[model samples]
Target chain A: MIAFISSFISRVMNTLFKGRKNIKLGLYGPPNGGKTTLANRIAKDWLGEEMGTVSAIPHETREIKIKEQVTIKSGKKELTFNLVDTPGIATKIDYEDFIKHGLSERESKKRAKEATKGVIDAIKWLDNVDAVIVVLDGTKDPFSQVNLTIIGNLAARNTPVLIVCNKVDLKKVKIKKVESAFPQYPVVGISAKFGTRIDEFYEALFTVFR
Target chain B: MLTLEFVPYHEIANLSSIGRIRKLLNIAKQNKIVLLEGRLKKEEEIELIKTTMEEINEDFKGIELAVIYPTKNDSGIFTKMKTNFVDMIAGNRLGLTIIGPASIVKAIKKDPTKIQLYTQELKKKARKKK
Candidate 1:
């Protein structure tokens, strides 16, 4: 009876003292490629946050948008995943519109001049991430300049990249060709717009995170 | 010389026959030199190409099966094409040339009319500048 009681106490102590592992994941891709869509999906279903804005416009997310302290349970382990959603990378448009969305015109114009700086800021944030989800448009060629640049940068950083082929529900989207082109990387296909294969996406997230 | 460009489809799920053809059409529109290279001779090579093409559609232009090195698989063609593609995409003149069987090369060489027409049109557009 004493041994049983001691074991119970030890288990309770372990649970109390064990710190939750916090993993930081970045969702990045070219403008209009559904980064926000995927981020919002994960935030809503797994992170328990309301869905953020989803739009067809490019550069919908102009700054580093973050949803912090999301708790996830796997088996007997509890983990915390801090999901960071970044603005789409646009060569032309800087954070002017993004700043204007929340600020006055003078401030928006001031930030616009620093648009290139915003991209640099986003790249710097990559160093802090544990893994990256590089989203690609399902209806366009996967070899676009922007997409390749993003992947190349991620690879250079030695960051594990999970290529998410978004908007797969569209009739014009193709998965096989993308798999063939990037044979070395882990690729997942999902329609972020409709949330299909979302559970599978989460499974992939857990696999890479673990 | 016959130039080939492999354009991977937009979506990972869209790596079907139809998706590949659509992507090819789009690439053809942007550049007149691009052609769809033939399939691999070996069944396994074909399968591997197909699988890889589906995942990394943007990375592959087409698979070239070289007759001189029949035993030597041409999977490296994708990486080479990717480099050339990047150069061209950056507004450079980097072109893609695929090495394949003699017969395939001869067949492509025989069709100069399409390339000639494209070049002629480009010259015509250039002449307008002068």
Candidate 2:
């Protein structure tokens, strides 16, 4: 009974406030999946800025960065929302792994500790976000537990999700593989680094959120 | 030697989400791979990951988890209804959950009907010549 009432109220609130300036759209995925890169792309496209710095090392964005009051237009419709770029989610964070990437032992340990906290923050943010864009690597297999757990959590929260397959400019990219992996959601392939097929991403974004 | 601990669904069915996650993490921290009879709810799975991240330290790295559930992809309507009935009665126990310490279990590759759980190989230090 309480569940039904809460769900009803949530739907009502979503209907009332969605597409307004207060909406929060979050970017989430596994580590090194180019979430910050896509976030930079979107922010630069509309807000004339970048959200956070991107690096080859994993867990570069170890905090929740938000760009407020960013507005986007598609055709005759325009939507304004806060773009939230969250830290990548990972199941494991070992200090040794960072050392393997050329960091000193102390730096590695520090990064590992921060990365773990970042993941916890990202998961907690699931409750606050109105919608999400799950960024995936097009060159890697998308059938991992991390991907499934992320999508499953979003589904459980009744949050609208759009899957973005990043890195389509690479020679080994396979956007179709990711699309097949998640046939239920709208998958857009774009190289956030090279800005390939990003217009289609914007079009799909409007359609999905509409 | 690897330790695989089998936990039936009923073992955790009565526990709260936090309790269940704690119990599983405790077991995995002991360097034992947990083979649970049923899968956890989506929320619980997320909570488990969150808790695991909080407990990561020098001794305890984290966890590698996987779930294998029976798929009725090509089933007819009658079969679908039967599966639904079973789920309703049994609380969706037609699956397996594997949780292992990241220190021990390297990776868990899962497909629809199979799971390949890779374990880390312990490296031995070189012996000095006498």
Candidate 3:
């Protein structure tokens, strides 16, 4: 009962104050799903600065980083929000997995600890964001547990979501599979690395936020 | 040897979200795959992940979880209504949930109708030479 009341109140508050100030838009997904790459793309496009470093190593962004008051203009329409780039969420975080990426045991343990805390932080932030952008790796299967969990949590909160099928530059990208997997939300295919089809993503953002 | 424990929905129906998460995590830490009769609430699922992360260590890595529920794609109106009625009576007990320790369960591949739980082969420790 309390949870439902709080969720209702938050939705009301979000609706009452939409577009009045910076909308807190969050980037969330599983590990190595290109969330940081998309965050960097959005930050570079609007603020002329990158949000965080991207790496092939999972959990590289082991903290919740934010770029404030980013404004993007499409024709006469303009949208401003605080773009929050969060760590990749995972069901399991093993230090040994980091060792496979060539990190020393000691460094791997430290990274694993930080990554665990990062997942907790990302889940906590779900309550604060008015809207969210779920980034998915287009080359991977979208029906994984992590993806379903993330989408389910968002649905439970009734938070607005835009699914970005990132890494479209790759040859084996399966954007359609992602779309079919999550047909409920709006899915856009884009190469956040090379900035291909980014305009479509920005355009889709309007539909979500509006 | 692998163990699978079946937990009925009534076993956790009255527990709070935190309580439910703790119960499931404790079972996973015991290195057994939990075959729950019904799925958890969405908020409970998030809490379960958070709790699992907090308890991760060398021996207890984490948990891999998946829920298999019936989709309402082609069901008739009466069938949909019957499902909803049962949900109201049984507190949404229309699905199955699986939670296993990450050390033992490599991955859980799930489709709408089936689940493929892949278990990793346990490595044998070397015996000492006298």
- What is the DockQ of the complex in model 2? 0.78
lDDT of 1 at A183: 51
DockQ (Cα-based) per candidate?
Answer: 0.03, 0.78, 0.73
TM-score of each model's chain B: 0.29, 0.88, 0.86
Chain A TM-score values for every predicted structure, listed in order: 0.76, 0.90, 0.91
TM-scores, all models, native as reference: 0.53, 0.91, 0.91
Candidate 2 per-residue lDDT, tens place, B1-130, comes to 7999999989998999999999998999999999999989989999999999999998799999998876543357888788778888887477899999998899998766678989987553112222
Model 2 residue A16 CA deviation (Å) reads 6.1
Model 3, runs deviating above 4 Å: A1-19, B73-82, B124-130
lDDT of 2 at A198: 95
Number of the top lDDT candidate? 2
* Model 1 agreement with the true structure over B52-130: per-residue lDDT tens digits: 2232222222222211111111247776686556645632122222222221222222111122111222354357669
Superposed model 2: Cα runs more than 4 Å off: A1-19, B72-80, B124-130
Error of 3 at A28 (Å): 0.4
Say which docking band candidate 3 falls in: medium
Q: Give the worst 10-residue stretch by lDDT in candidate 1 chain A.
A: A90-99
Candidate 3 lDDT, tens digit per residue, B1-130? 7899999988988888888888888998998999999899888888889888888887788988998876553358887787777878876577889999998998998766678999876663122222
Q: lDDT tens digits, residues A30-83, model 2?
A: 999999999999999998988889999899999999999888897787777888
